[model samples]
Target: MAAKAHLQEQIRQLPHRPGVYKYFDDEGIIYVGKAVDLRKRVSSYFTKQDHNKKTQQLVKNIKRIEFTIVDNESDAFLLENNLIKQHQPKYNILLKDGKTYPYLCLTNERFPRLIPTRKKINDGSRYYGPYANLTAMNVVLELIRALYPLRTCTYNLTPENVAAGKFKVCLEYHLGNCKGPCEALQEEETYNQYIQQIRSILNGNLTIPKAYFRERMMAAAQEQQYELAHTLKKKLDRLDDFQAKSTVVNASLSNIDVFSIASNEKSSFINYLKVMNGSVILTQSLEVQKKLDEMDEEILPPLIMQMREEFESDSKEILTNVALPSLPLPGVTVSTPQIGDKRKLLELSIKNVLYLRKEKESMNDRSKDLNEVRIMETIKKDLRLTELPKHIECFDNSNFQGDNPVAAMVCFRNAKPSKKDYRHYHIKTVIGPNDFDSMYEVVTRRYRRLVDEGASLPQLVIVDGGKGQLSMAVKALKDLNLWGQIPVIGIAKRLEEIYVPNDPLPLYIDKKSESLRLFQRMRDEVHRFGITFHRNRRDAATLKTELTEVKGLGPATADKLLSKFKSVKKIRELSEAELVAEIGKAKARVLLSYFEQQEQAAE
Candidate 1:
């Protein structure tokens, strides 16, 4: 408590300005975060009572707090990203992927070779991309090879080596894939020109190469060389297909970056698209596991700065679904579009982010289902049960403020609802709002019938009320001599404390535990079942009472009308002819006359 008071005093001294803050425990920095207002953001940790498990643990460990003031939000954003990278605080979100993306490196060698590489070192060679997918890099490499006869072999190819015949051309030269640059048969100037053309294409400009192929194809056909033209036509088609697929917006839109973000309780997803010449040259989608409960807007700016640096994006203009007052780069233009091609491009980026989020959620759901099997194990441990509660039943009693009392039992098998085994019972032995008596009657009837029929019994039984209801259920089980054969417990409404058969004090399960969640789900299911049954019974009773007042109409006839129209409201709306066809003229006239008088009296 003294430590907490000191921390509160420290928080009171924080300035209301934009900055980065670091949290330190005895071990070291556990978390680092950025905020628009230092005092407000840092205060929220101690001020808010509701936090996720990880946040609670983080707050519990903090022994000290520190802050660094920045000029504005942009500096704060960049500083936060750099600090996270440099320190890698234990509680900060980080991307899970480890594969370094591939790049097309133009090597600094004689007759420079085009190479696909994952490493970018400090060489004079220019690196084109850190492609999100290796396949995109390969397609570009294949197209470059098909367009120009570049060397594949790695030789020094120095003037002295070429003159001394240090290397000879291999099969590549014969196959028309290389121009024999190692043998000095191809000039350096000519090879460099082809390299320049490849660079242009790599920058998402395909117009020159496509035009060159089309012109050559047409010229060859005019020269009466059908085979050569056919070959050129195929290359042209490949280039056309590649261009068409990559061009998402107008082809004239160049040097632009688009970003979108989506977040849920656990993680944030961001998608980036680098557009040049109106085609998508690079695409990346990243998932950041959330810590400290950051919102979507708060998470996006730092991510944008990080991704822009990581992907080497130099676009002057950016499109995004999120506003960017925090990202105040001097030369950069960040805008959220309402209408036009820019809006479409922003929507496309958002679409990719949403799709990625949905895919991740589906995978998490599958993982959760597999993880739920462990929940049964957790239940077994938490309850000190002899075996896993693979089959469990929960009981709940419902009424309309002490009328129409009923009880329901819902079954769960393998941590999921087993609706087929669910049972709803009218309170046959209990009068008024006597939940304990109703629980006793339902428990005895349910298990005795199961025992007589030789049906499998549930491993665990739960009653919705506290010790009173649990005592009744326990008594029923003992009378049937099944008390020790099965486990029965009750949950109190106030704190959800679990009461066992003979225990005076309740056992408290962790609120965040999946076992507790499973228990809560069963409680909810039984409550729904009981309430629905009660409503139907009460409604049918009222309808029967009114029908009994119709002189010739009995409950049997009332039931027939209810089965057909589903409610008395619908039965009262039926025409004379419709009612007569069902119950004959005499009974129909009496029913209609009674309904008319009832409506007139109400009016």
Candidate 2:
């Protein structure tokens, strides 16, 4: 109670200005927050009753508070983001498990060297990307190497060393893959021109280099230099192909940065698109783990600033799906468009973020499926089967007092139900409610057709009965010469005991084991399927019997009525005039009178 009073007093003393605040526990800083008005925001934490679970926990853990006043909300926002990144406070959404991405660095030297590095140095060098991934970075490196014969050796290509002829041409020079700049065989001006063109290509601005190549190709063709013209044409075609693969949005919507966010309960996915001259020069999606219940406005601005700084975007206008608070950064306008080409661009950004979310979900689903496959493999090994039971079929019989007895077979492939392969059977060759006989008839008919048509057979077959049904199914398989070819098991309903064909006693699988659970699921599914089929058949039979008892309703008339109305209740509900349109007036009158007499008897 004393601590609560002290915290409330501290909140009361807070200044009503923009600032960043820190919440600390015994260990260290646990959370960082920003607010436009420090007094109101800080007081609400201790006063509000409807806080989310995470926020409530955070409030309980906080033992002390510290704050820094800023000039405005934007300054507070920047300070808050920096502190979160540096301290990575416990109750902040973090981009976990990622190192700084790799970028193609061009060194600041008289002759620049292009190489991949993970660090961004402040020396007077240029960086093209933090590329989408390592593979993309490598591809760009290979493309640059092919386009220009640049030197790869890390030699100090000082003018003094080159003029003194201290270096010898290496194998790369002889193979015509390098211009031998270290030996002074390549002039500085010409090499710098090639470097400039490579830089433009890396930046996704291909117009200048592309036009230069096209003009050279045309000039060479006019001079009748067919080979040189063909070579230039090939290079131009490669440039065109690369541009064609890039996503291009509206041509006039140039020099803008786009960001969109999609979030679920646990994490937020943010996709960033860099547009230069209306083309998407770069795209990246990042996932951040949420530690507290933060709103989109709270999470997005910090991330947007981080991405902009990482990509070195200097666009005057930024586009997003949600409106952003005024940022402290000068000369920048952040707008959420409602119509026109900018809105379309915002829609495109949203589409990319959604795609990234789906891709991550799909990857997680595939991992789960692989785990399921492994579980199925273990079941196969434990059962000591000849082959992995990738395809399994289970059968169950259902009947009610010897009426409409039916059997159903449910198929499971890779431990999941395969509904299309499920089959239903009426007790064609069995009599009464004899489950063993029903099992035998269904098994024989199922495998007989499969054998006749040369269809694929299930690796395992299960019967939902004890030893009696198991013995009958075994006899049917033996009669069909398939007893040893396919493995079969039976499960009892009461104790969940499994019965194999040649085993004297039942095999008791552990109740909690995955294999036993799978067997139980298959048993329950087949039981449900069989019961549904049996009920449907019984209802149709009862409807037919009731229809035939009416006067002037023979077998043909009953069949016609059943086909037209689907049920006797539907026929009962139809008016006499509506029935006359289908049949004649005489029959319609008889049907109406029959229904009236039945209702009066019930009353």
Candidate 3:
């Protein structure tokens, strides 16, 4: 209590300005936060007036506060995002991602084909909008197919076919989107011109298409094809209407990104509106908690500069980059316009900002019930168990070939990892890289130790492998006289597959199923932990040759220093002065000279 009071006093002395803040739990575990006014924001949590149900809960658990003052609001915003991505605070409303939105891609081939996909491949393909609504995207696709009856088929029309005109036009040609190049009804030069026009339409150049359609309609009317002329005119009109609505937000601007930042004294939110060809294509929000003052301007300029630098260094992901202050260039009206299209875009962006703020407030209210309580309930019913699986133990084995085999067992309570209960074992029973046997040994050891201590057994055991691995697990449970007493299941490697005993092949649980994704997440985490442990073992084993039997350097510290420096050759190359620069000059000079002397003796 005295220590916490002292920490509170320290927090009160912080400046009432923009900065990042962090909260530590009673156990000294840190959760990061940001604040616009550090003094006021931090002080608010300790005051009786600020004690809401959620704030009171946070204050009760908080033991200390730490802060880093930044220059302005935007700096605080960018810093907060970076920290959130790093620490992932429990109280923060995190950005959620499951399945990626599909993109419409036109592949670059002799005969191109349009495809819908979530993944962005490196192959030469032109991708368009991350369309917010899939139904609308499909509508566009249908429209394209109806209007451009090109070869939707993947078949290549070779030189022989070009000369022979062997293939006949499909139903698509009759609809209109394509000239039957496969049937050689159109010359290559003429077909290429149509392709060029399609590209122009995609680039939002409406004039060329309007002119072409009008010309076609006029020619048909002259030839007394009244029905064709009227149909073409109707299609042309529809295209114009589609273009108008598409750019309702920013009709004049071609491509730009609009950013708006909103902040209260303690937190900030930035909304990014991605515009392409005068349309507000996508909007994303980033939230920041930091100290703010009236004098602070948005720090976007410097943050963007740093972002560009990181991008050049291949160290960061830059989704969109546009010149700040958005001015129109010589021939391009690139400036942030105050009227018409730009104003509409800005208005839409503001709406998005407000929408996210409201959504976050609602999420904060519901986050109290956001624990893996549902996970326990689902597993309990799924296994038809006597009690809820409040405590789950998952096991995984990792090895490279036959070397440095290791296994890990992770415990999850109420759907979160109990880090204190995680256990790793260097394979003792298994001599080779046999995952099944290794899993059995790992499970046996973990359970046997709990039994020896008279501790309660976990309600479930999850193996991170397929059916064969599950069989080994079942055998282990039988040996302990606990077969079927504790529910067990296996998660297969490929396609997030799952398998149970007596089941044929593997079953895929839908991504929308929270319980299933939770189980898969646990399995993946255990596998990752095991793999990490195995890598450390392998690295240690390989670096054994570089270790010094020096008096002051113990194996653990030697390993730490080696791991820190990576290789002995690099360590040897590091000058006595350089070594001092890295670890400390005192250790460097002595350590380097010692190594040099040893090397001379060995020679």
Q: What is each predicted model's overall lDDT from 0 to 1?
A: 0.87, 0.86, 0.68
Worst 10 residues of 2 by lDDT: 93-102
Of 2 and 3, the candidate ahead on TM-score is 2
Per-residue accuracy of model 3 over 1-603 as CA lDDT, tens digit each: 122667767876899898988887866534565667888777766765634465566666777777889997667766776675567666553433313765677877766666777777888888765554577567666655555555776657886866776678888678766777787776777656656666665555656777888899999999999999998898788777767666445456655655555555455566665555556445456666542232113334333333222212121122222335321122323234466656666666667767777787778656745656776787776656688888998899888889888898889887788989898999898998898998888877877777789899988888998988988888887887777677788887776776776776775556667667778878878888988888877876777645655655557756767877787777778766666666676666666767878889999
Worst-scoring 10-residue span by lDDT in model 3: 311-320
Give me the overall lDDT of model 2.
Answer: 0.86
Please tell me which predicted candidate would have the highest TM-score against the true structure: 1
RMSD of each: 12.4, 10.5, 24.2
Better of 1 and 2 by lDDT: 1
Better of 2 and 3 by lDDT: 2
TM-score of each: 0.68, 0.63, 0.43
* Candidate 2 or 1, higher TM-score: 1
Best by lDDT: 1
Output the TM-score of candidate 3.
Answer: 0.43
- Best-first order by lDDT: 1, 2, 3
TM-score of model number 1 = 0.68
Candidate 2 local Cα displacement, residue 74, angstroms: 1.2
RMSD of 1: 12.4
Instruction: Give the TM-score comparing model 2 with the true structure, all chains together.
Output: 0.63
